[model samples]
Target: MTEIDVATKAPESNATEQPAEPIESSPAAGPAVGEHCVTDRPTPAGQVSTGEIIKINDVEVYVSKPADYPHAPARFLLLLTGGTGLKSINNQLQADNFASEGFLVAMPDLFNGDPAPNTTTFASQEESQSLIDAFKLRIVETAKSFQIDMWLARQTEEKVLPILHKVIDGCRDEFADAIKHGDGIYAVGYCIGGRYVLLLGSDAQPTTPGPERPADEEAGETKTGPLIKVGAVAHAASVTPKDFASLRVPVSLACVENDALFPDDVRVAGEDVMSQANLEHEVRVYPGVPHGFAVVGVYEDATIRGAQATAYEQMLSWINEH
Candidate 1:
């Protein structure tokens, strides 16, 4: 069998307001109300005054919080991690933005050491050109190879969830008093990280999503699974409609309109799957942006920044609602 492709790839007001009008949750639908470059509110204030890297059970997570809120009560525990490759400057920035919104943000370096982001440059723009086609084929195969390795080794069971367990423990210790009152833990991921958090929604065992238990889980399990109150992802790669089959919590997916790696079909499939499962979810495609716009392009383009802001608000709104 061919390996599946693994593509190389914020919060609002405190006052409660009327519920947002639901966006279309199906792939075949057209754009929704807030899916465009529309910014009706002021830029959210960045309350995060401190940004530092902290160790959580030996795993390094970039931690950010309000200087005054160091011990302030948390509203939720946020596990924010970025895309397909290594962490980037922008990833930290994205995390900081969420932290500013008053969550106890924990963005972990799941891959251990920093690795370079995947790079691709095409020789031609023509759709029928052999060079372009070959390049596209290579991307698919490469992404597939990467996803296979991830599924075999770095998935939630083997790596991320374990890290999250430790990180949550560390947060409880670090914010001993404040974290005690948080409503719940929420996650926001980009690209590959997005895929991981989505996988958390599944009841199936990680690494191997099946009924057969791994040797470690053969005996009745003692620890609880990663309990995410809600999840939101943007331009996620390597996830499919089937992945959402058992997701019990609400999710908000922010898709890029022109993303080559995760295009309309992928977004539509996710919508279809979630709808079929009768899951509470929303799908919004930001118009005219490519993949990775939420983080990388937020600083480079005003239009992208606008889209990012909208996605950020919508994510927070969804989390707040649930």
Candidate 2:
């Protein structure tokens, strides 16, 4: 088992729109989105997969259904995209991976098809390989055409949470006939997607400052319950102290070494917040691998690959346990 090390902290918008979108940083927020190069690739060969591209809210979504299971998958998982803005092949493979494990996966295109003004579209792995694989993507400047932060600004929590809810509804409606009783929706987020997933699992927390502020009697607005049953995040970015503070559901966070986005200070400070909140949570540090390794790392070294695999298993075990 990986050693757990996370805690909690702050919030940004009213839970009104649990932004898959990045809002302005509060005092407690982590680092903002970074400029990274992500390419779309097919699911690696030899793993059974059946995935379909569907549309929800006029945006394209990749839905992966269980391929091998004793029974129909009893859980629903929203496989959120990282900095790649949803066309990422890693996201597709992740969706399939979860689906293969009896968790129906619904991954929406956060950026639709075009993430930015000068983005390049690689129709297949062969095409992407020409430039990115040619250079091993060692130089971030090679993919200078695509900037993740420029796109994240447009996909705010207000804009994205509704789509997430719609995805959940569609999944439920599709499976309504087959099963009525099962575990509720769960979320798995990576990179920028991690912040959103945490919000989805959050129970309502105090909006106003101070210890236990009263409800907003002016609007008579009572807080709502969380959107998912359980959640996990890997190498999350743009996460804040406030975001952790508001969380009330069980969550597990996987941290990477010297991450510019989820830096050491932010990660360590989170522990205090979660401890005070007394939330059921686990946070682990996977040394050696870089921040985006969980989603986008392509490693030949056995050790790095093993760490990635183990962290993934830890995520699944946590989800299953909850």
Candidate 3:
């Protein structure tokens, strides 16, 4: 059975040893995990065949290629991690599943190897709970909703879009021959990552030329362009209808029925936008599945597992058909 690839810190060696060779900064050099080099060791059995960190554009991406790599220049799937970034165990499993199935998976560390901003605060449980209570009461007293839109807007523009460009740029620059040559690139996003996926398809064209730009651009002229051909968003949050209307390619949405962030009405609004635009799409509500279902691996509920499996299959099918 396939197992999660957990990153373990090597124990400190007390004895002095010969000086290690100066590392070169090249794809052949492989990525570094602190002082030790990832290329020094082989990917363990049962884990994805090839797992290493590589610089895409300039940002680091944890790439996992299948054992049967170079079989046919497999389709490339650029997966966007949720707010938890690449450390999310469930997100890692999702990427592994795709790589195991012959899709080259590249996941960028959206947080640049740092914890998400809102993940921690106050430095103490008591202080955190007090703030939470005050925040909750403020929300209850005032009808003002959370500023998810503003947060998403800033993140997408400042961090997400640039990283995405770099990842695609890296794919074309470094892995052209290793990956399938065509525009078979796809994207899958969870939570805030899902919102980024929607923004990638959103109507506002990136000021910079990207893979998602019009087909009229000279082919092969721009290697760093947006190349995502299709996409899927799972239990996405903070995305609006205008976002759906801006999509250039077909997309599928695996919405959780119990998603408070992306509730039934929000899902319906997105569907309505897609339909009005006459875009080819699929939007389904997975009953009983809650938000973050795709990114929290420790939750072992049977229903959540089944829902995740179904959603994964649906994304694969959509990518296959489109």
Q: For each candidate, what is the lDDT?
A: 0.58, 0.65, 0.59
How far off is model 2, as Cα RMSD? 8.6
lDDT of 1 by residue, 79-106 (tens): 5554332245556666667777777677
Q: What TM-score against the true fold does each predicted structure earn?
A: 0.65, 0.73, 0.66
Clashing pairs in 1: 4-144, 5-143, 5-144, 6-143, 6-144
Model 3: pairs clashing at backbone N, Cα or C within 3 Å: 203-246, 210-225, 210-226, 211-225, 211-226, 211-227, 212-226
Off by over 4 Å in 1: 1-49, 84-87, 117-157, 176-179, 207-226, 296-301
Stretch of 10 with least lDDT, candidate 1: 31-40
Task: Give lDDT for model 2.
Answer: 0.65
Q: Against the true structure, whose lDDT is highest? A: 2
Question: Against the true structure, candidate 3 has what lDDT?
Answer: 0.59
Global lDDT of model 1: 0.58
Model 3, 1-322: lDDT tens digits are 1221111111123123343333222333211111010001112235433467777777888787777777766777778876556654445666887788777788888766652433222123453457779887577534312332233334544556677766777787666764455355778887667766766665454445567756865442223323577788777765554455456667888876656666555566665555555566777677765566654353346777777677788788877766
Model 2 off-target regions past 4 Å?
1-31, 35-49, 68-73, 116-146, 177-180, 204-222
**Per-residue CA lDDT of candidate 2, range 1-322, in tens?**
2443443323321234322322233565534665332443334556443688887656678888776543643566778876575656666777777776777678887655655333334333554467656676546545453354456566666566666766666766765532343457778888778888877776652232434545552232126578777888888887776577567777888888777788777766665556555567777787777566676345666666787788788788878776
